[model samples]
Target chain A: MKKILNSADTFVRDTMEGIEAAYGDRVGLLDGDFRVLVSRYPAPEGKVGIVTAGGSGHLPLFLGYVGQGMLDGCAVGEVFASPAAEKMADMIRACDRGAGVLCLYGNYNGDVFNFRMACEDVEFDDIETRQLLGRDDVASSPKDRADKRRGVAGLVYAFKIAGAAAERMMTLDEVTAVTARALDNIRTMGVALSPCIVPKVGQPTFTIEEGQIEIGMGIHGEAGIEVRPMMTADEIARLILETIEADMPLNAGDEVSVMINGLGGTPLEEQLIVYRSVHARLAERGVAVVMPHVGEFATSMEMAGLSVSVFKLDAELKELLRAPAATPFYTNANK
Target chain B: MKKILNSADTFVRDTMEGIEAAYGDRVGLLDGDFRVLVSRYPAPEGKVGIVTAGGSGHLPLFLGYVGQGMLDGCAVGEVFASPAAEKMADMIRACDRGAGVLCLYGNYNGDVFNFRMACEDVEFDDIETRQLLGRDDVASSPKDRADKRRGVAGLVYAFKIAGAAAERMMTLDEVTAVTARALDNIRTMGVALSPCIVPKVGQPTFTIEEGQIEIGMGIHGEAGIEVRPMMTADEIARLILETIEADMPLNAGDEVSVMINGLGGTPLEEQLIVYRSVHARLAERGVAVVMPHVGEFATSMEMAGLSVSVFKLDAELKELLRAPAATPFYTNANK
Candidate 1:
């Protein structure tokens, strides 16, 4: 593999060690447990604690989001493998203050199952917690089975909005309610130009014909929902937006935040190019984009693709999304 | 080439369109001249106007820094090709606010020649202007010939320090003095794992064996000063830090801001892994790291490698580096 790493066995641990070394003032491991990361600045007592956990490889997602005005703690897993339930329980306990903790994570079989077990364990300790699943990717399932869909880049909006709500000292139930609302309003779809090699696998996850593009491919390179000849940036933007609008029914005067998230290998230049078409298409439909995020907010390790997430916002959601966020990997001006 | 673009001829234009569409609030083109990007909130009458220009393909480099507290304007060129002197002159005239303008750009042959001509053209218009070149690539030249060295990732520090000075309403001479001090204290080196395909070229810039790497490779795949078998991330970090220290002489009590910038295709996970070693080595030497930036701050489109920039700072540079700055691609919390 043409990757800059020491060994496949220690890829995840090495990454965590590096993360702590770089952002020690803002984030650190929980009691020297490298798998559990918590913010260095703890929230006030009675403030709801937000926690997210998932497999590694997706930086700025489960792990990079833990800091001031964002997630309180994150239980990190190995590459594409869920963390242990005990680790998740430990993270929850660390982030828990007088207010209850919220288990906010992506909706995946491994993650959901482990988090369910974690909540059960934490329940025995009498730490109140609420579970909120991020189900925003429209390609994994039909709208009728939305709850079964997998989460992708849209998970960023969940962390952002929910973290902002918790930072504002909302109750656990209130934070969960708003986060669920965000999940319900968010939709994300990805187009993969190339496959990525997992550290452990040491080979391409999948192969496709050269110059072909796969729409709605999972981050892990699972079979795409639609594979076709490579389309122009405008065409790709249209296909993704139409699919989302059909499911969410965005209309004139609708205000939303748009994120063009590079998976891993794509450059910010291309993400902005895609965002141009996305913004133009939305402008044509009279939909206003408030906060435009274009970069690698979430990524699969060295995967060449980009995902677009549209989170339709109301007044309250808009305010929360605009609230200042200061994480090691992300920071906002609070404008 | 496997790129999400409309046409190769319009690659730069397409990127500009996308950037302006997404960040119109923070940056825009001058009049109908798309090559000249100026900040939306122009500098006040007496504030020094900071303008940077260079060939494209480096996101957040010459273009992304044009905004409040960073750059007043930038004249953009094609991918790896310098912009015309007329466009540079136009950018200078547009940013001039009675108080002089400072032209801050990299030290490249085509750019130096072009900016020299640009200043001459503006001199006739009676618009006061001064020029400062960023030269920090230790690999490009020896300390005895540092003036001939090429500028690379260390250019980011120049912009950050210079932009902060201009925003504080420093005079042209004052801004020039502080920026020159920053340039003298900076050093950079890069290691390339793979090459990137220029959109118009439709081919990789260069190639290497499957398990080989090139140290000190330029962003456009220029011949490296050193090539060897692939090394672990720790080894790579040591090689780079050793080279930079040889040139800059970092001391035990020195305080520096480190930037491990990914060249498009390197994932943040690997970047952090490298940072882990970089931080450990610095700590061992008793050199303090402040405001570490680890990401794709500057990139070659889809190039799989990274560059390390260490800018030793004093009290003044440290405050300026930490000052609040907001651009489309960057922002600081003003902490």
Candidate 2:
């Protein structure tokens, strides 16, 4: 329950100010908005300007992804809420290179609505744009079609491919094509072990029984599809992999990259335990894991569950994933 | 206190097995030790092998850092303990290139003894080796002579510069030079808000009052110098920065890379607040922050608190840092 803030309302703004202060020389804030652009006004001409925006609270996800290789800019909103339309517009305008901008974001209603609105606003300023809403959360949809599901940690992988393509000065259409490919290959599902308390609300976002878990909770504390008794690490991993496989329809001999992300409260040891179960289950099915990342890649505030994400990798996607990436949240250094 | 493990003694081995199972195609365990090497073994013949080893619990550190553009290999031991001399020797042998091998690690009695033993073993085998003991924790030493302090988060900067140099095919001596420069310029101080639990002990690593903090804590839950009542965000930032400034002898207008790393249990929002205080203080002094990262870099299980590290960037060090890096624990994508 402890926090360091003057008040809940100022948390997002103050935090953004800090981010700007830290990287101000390389990044700049749009006047009077949540938009942040990599400094120097516009990126090199002909490059597809990469922009990702979403609600705050997921550091490195919505904003921390902005830098040399990942996002060109990010529009941040208040905690768990979409940024205002004007903010998204300003962010796009700042990063636009005349080749056009690609609006990459999660598939939450508020984010979609605002980002779509911003698309119109930027178009009015004579800048062309394309919107690609990520729908990669397999747990939220049935087996036949997961594109209708929500998007969660899968955005990180998509960002990697899209960012790499954009950095190569790929056309907007090319960038979009690669991003969609990466998105289609990505599937994610998260469980909630404990609820997160919004700073403004000062209460639990959701509730679960002691020693129990919610199998398909959304990032904003939305209810899950099912509530299940507490299970062992292996059991949880099986349920998650089973659900994701059903939705994504991965078959034997598929090459995949796996991520077991902690939802804040879990320790690295415990996450590794989850990964152990996940890897064993995948091995039994003959799938080859090309890359495995075990840590807190994305997190909800103090939530204890872990989310599993699998990205079926192709030659191009594997190369992009192997491409170097550095951000505040993730480092490739041998520290 | 709940954990998913057959027993405490089995944790490290089990975890390594799981990592190999998941990433065996990309990474492999050294022939007979806990050291993990990026698959393809022995890197290029002339490529300097950057080897880092320490205790197991700090994931992404010893293991996560061993990948492309970073470490060639890492040796791991039980939780909070150094690898055995033979294991360290085996790790050096597995990773050594004709150029030489560099033994970079933390400064602790167990680590120093075992690493020295490793150096001797490697020399007996005719593989030249050098040691770069990281001692960047400023709180343990006064401003006049901080070289005696133990290493903390600052070791990350050293690793990055060294790893990047090695990736560029620098000779072992050259890599060692860059690493020494990084170590000289780097400084870190950590504060603990809560303590981690060691599985073997099945208890908290240290204790603190609900609202108190321990400044200058060692990574293994060792006691800190000051046990002050909790203060505002600004106060904590000032304390950390002042200690760093005094210890590093950094003057105004110095360009530095800063990292505010969470111990484990602290949330990102809290870390951002700490970042706010940190940036504001540095900005007031006109210090140029070249690179700023805020997140869980080097953790102590689920212990809460954060460490602040500043590395005064010089031309070569900055270039190496800007080099592309990609690992399981971090990434700095190529521009």
Candidate 3:
């Protein structure tokens, strides 16, 4: 594979080393388990600790959120592979400050099974915990089966809101409630124009003819809903917005936050254009946008395309999203 | 070409629309001139205002730096084409306060010609202005011929340091002096693995054989120092670090900042891996890295590769680098 790495076998470890080297003041690996990354400064006494974990290849996703106003720790896995249950348990135990912990992550089968094992593994710690999975990808499943949906860019909202609640000294039950509410308000859809190769696989995860697009593709190159000829930026933005609205309808006078996340290879300019369209469409619907994010919040390792996420908001959600946060890849100081 | 644009004709303006839509609260298009973007909250009275201009396609370049505590205004151009002198004059006039304005941008032929014309055009306005060019690419020219070097990722440093000097209310001459010092102490180099397709051009800027790399290539696909087979991330990092050291030696006990900038399509995971290597190599020589950045700061559109920039800093320079600055795409809340 034409990837800039020393070796495929050590890809994840090498990436983690670089991340720790660059952001040591902010985050580092847990002492007992190298796969678990914890914030340098733990939460205050009696404050619930927020933790997350997921596969690799998506920067700013699993570990990039660990910091002052965000996640407390995270368990990292190999590229697109789930981490072990013991690592998750180690993260939970380390982050527990006698205020319990929250196991937040995506809705992948591998991740779901491991998180279950992790909760049982930490039962003796006497620290109550809650499991909240981000199931915001509306295109993955119908409205009646939202639990089966794959979490995508909207997972970022879950991290921000949940972390803000915990940082504000919310109890474990309160933090879980707000996180679940935030997750329920999020709806996301994506379009992919090209495939990305896994360094170890040395091949494209999937293929499409040049000048075509895949609708509703999973981050790990799972089959999208359909393959069709490429559409203009505005067309793609409108289609994604329409689909999201169909599922989580944003009516007149409603307010929300919008995110146009790039799937790695897309340029920031293009993502902004997509954001412009999304905002314009929302404005036409009389919906106000509070804190909008347009960049590569989550990516599929150089895959070409973008995802649009809208989080319907209330006063509390707005304040939580705007809470001061400082992480290596993300910083929202507009408190 | 596979791009998410509405049309190649309106690429620049459409992108500008998106940018203004997203960051309208922080920046807006200059009245009576759509090509010039000025900060919403201009610099305080009597503070030196900073303005920069260059061709488009490089997001977070000229326009992305225009906001609070950064550039006061910027003139936007068509993709890879220099903006007209009158537009630059408009930006200069809009940003100029009672004190003066600083014209800091890359040392490009068209940009140099236009900035000169722009200053002369606004001379009748009776507002004093100073010109500073960024020339940090060591691959384009040797140290003795540094003036002939092309600006690349190091231009971001110029914007940040110079903007910080201006924001802190330094005198026009003083800001110019510190900016010149920062430019003198900086060095940058890059390698492009594949070509980027310009929107209107409808073709690759330059072509390379598969799995090959163009060492020291320019952002606009300009020919590099040489072409060779792709090397491992560690080898590439060492080669670049050694080359930079050969020209500007970094001895023991040296303190500086490092940046591993992705060229557009490269994954963040890969960039972090490269950062890991660069940091390890620097540490081997007893150099201390502060405020290391690993992401897409300045980029060529959809190009596959990355650039490394090192800013050798003194006490004052380090403080300025750590100063708080916030733009739409770049935010340094760390002070």
Candidate 4:
């Protein structure tokens, strides 16, 4: 493999150490575990603790979200491997304030099982906990089976809404409700031009022939809906938008937030090209984009692909999205 | 070539269109010119106009930095090709708000020539302008000949200082002085594990054998100091830091800002691993790291490599670095 890593065995630990060292003033490891990263910024008294956890390959995702006005902590696993329940429990314990804790993560099977176990573990200590699964990938399931879909870049929307709600001193139930609402409003679909390699595997997780593309692939090289000849930027944007709009049924005068996310290897220039197409199509449909984000929100290590996410917003959701946030990898307008 | 693009010929314009579509509220293309991007946030009367420009492919560098308290405007060229002098002149005319304009870019021949021409073009209009060339790549020159080196990620520091100085309403000469100081204090070096494919060329910029690295490689695949066997993370970190310290003659109690920038393809997980080593090594040398930024500040498409930039900071530089800035890609603590 042509990766610049010491060894697969130490990759995760080394990355965690680097994160702590680089952002020492803002983030640190949880007391007993280096895999659980917690914010150095104190959790406000009686504020709901917001925690997100998942595999390590997707940076600026779970751990990178831990900071003021965002996640309180995150449990990180090895590349593409879900963290153990113990690690999640540690994160929950460390992030918990008087108001209780809420856990948010993608809807992968391993993540679901581990987080469920962690919730039970934390509950044994009388720390009330709630869980919300983000399954916003419209291509993964039919509109009627949205719960079966997997989450992708749309998880950022959930993070924003839940973080803002917690920052507003919302109770655990209120935070959970708003987080679910954000998750429900989000829809994502991706097209992959190439596959990503897992360090431990020392090979690509999947393969694609040159000049072909995989539509609806997951962040970790999961199977997509179809593989076809490569399409132009405009064609790809239309396909993904039609699929999402079919599920969400966006209409004229609808206001929503748009995210054109790069899967590791895709450059921001290409992502912006995709965003331009998206914006044009949305305008044609008379849908107004309220807030637009174009960059690598979540990624598969060096995978050349991009995902488009649309979060239909309401007044409440728009306010939450607009709230100030500060993190090492992400900072919104927080003046 | 496996790329998510429409065609090489239209890539630059398409990307620009996408940027405008996504960030229409915060940025817009200069009137009568699509290559020059100016911020929607109006320049205050009598405030120095800060502008930076360079070839394309480095997203969030020239164009992404144009927003509040960062850059007033930027001239973008085709991938790895400098924008025409006419575009730069147009940007200068538009950004100038009666307090003159300050031009900052890397120490590249084409950039230097075009910007010089632009200054002359606007001279007829009586708009005073000052230029600062960022030549901080230590490996590109000996310590005594630092001015001969090329610029890399260190240019970002120059932008921050000049942007903040202008935001504080510094005169054209004062902003130019601080920017020059920032450029002088900055040093950078990079290693490339693999080559990146230029969209127009449809081929890798250069090639390297598997398990090998090119140390001190340029952002556009220019020749590096040496080619060596791939080393462990600690070994690589030591080599880079030692080289930088040797050039700067760093000593105990020295304070610096560190930036571990990923060349597009390197994942954040791996970047953080490198950052961990950088932090530890700097600590071992008794050098204090003031503000640490660990992410993809500058990139060469999806090149699988990284660069380290160290900026020795004074009190004035530190305050400017800490000053609030907001852009689509970056936002600093403002409150």
Name the candidate that leads on DockQ: 3
A29-80: candidate 3 lDDT, tens digit per residue: 8884558899986678898999988999998787889998889999988889
- What digit string (tens of lDDT, one per residue) describes model 1 on residues A1-335? 88998898989999999988988888899998889999988689888999989999988777988888889999978899899999999999998997999888888888899999999999988999999888888988998998889988888888888889998889889999999999999999999998888889999968867889998998878676988999888899999999998899999999999999999988777887899999999999999999888888889878888999999999999999999888888876722
Error of 1 at B140 (Å): 1.6
How would you encode candidate 4's per-residue C-alpha lDDT over A1-335 as one tens digit per residue?
Answer: 87777789999899888888888788898874678989888777899999988998998787888898889999988888899999899888888887899999999999999999999998888999999999988888878877899988999889989999999998999999989988889999999998988999998867999989999999988889999998988899999999988888999999999988899998898898888899999999899998788888999888999999999999999999999888888776721
Candidate 3, B1-335: lDDT as tens digits: 77888899888887888887888888899983658889987577888989999999888787888887789999978888789999999888888887788999888999999999999988899989999988888899887898899888898888889889988899999999999999888899998887888899888867878778889999998898999898899998998998899888998999989989999989999999999999999999999998997899888988989999999999999989999888887877731
Question: In candidate 3, which residue pairs get closer than 3 Å at backbone N, Cα or C atoms, i.e. clash?
Answer: none
| Model 1 chain B poorest 10 in a row by lDDT | B326-335
- The residue-by-residue lDDT of candidate 1 on B87-170, one tens digit each, is 999999989888888898888989999999999999999988888898887888788998988888888889999999988888
Query: Of the true interface contacts, what fraction does each candidate have?
Result: 0.68, 0.38, 0.66, 0.71
> What local lDDT score does residue A304 receive in model 1, on the 0 to 100 scale?
87
Clashing residue pair totals per candidate (backbone < 3 A):
0, 11, 0, 0
lDDT of 2 by residue, A100-217 (tens): 8888988888989898899998878899898887887777777566556787888888887887888788899999999998988888888877776677987785578875788888
Worst 10 residues of 2 chain B by lDDT: B33-42
Instruction: Give candidate 2's whole-model lDDT.
Output: 0.77
lDDT accuracy of residue B108 in candidate 4:
91
Residues B32-118 of candidate 2: C-alpha lDDT, one tens digit per residue? 444444434336788888888888777656676777777777888788988788887887887777888888888888989998988
DockQ of each: 0.68, 0.31, 0.69, 0.64
**Per-residue lDDT for B247-296 in model 4, tens only?**
87777888999998899998998888888898888898899998788888
Candidate 4 stretches with Cα past 4 Å from truth are none
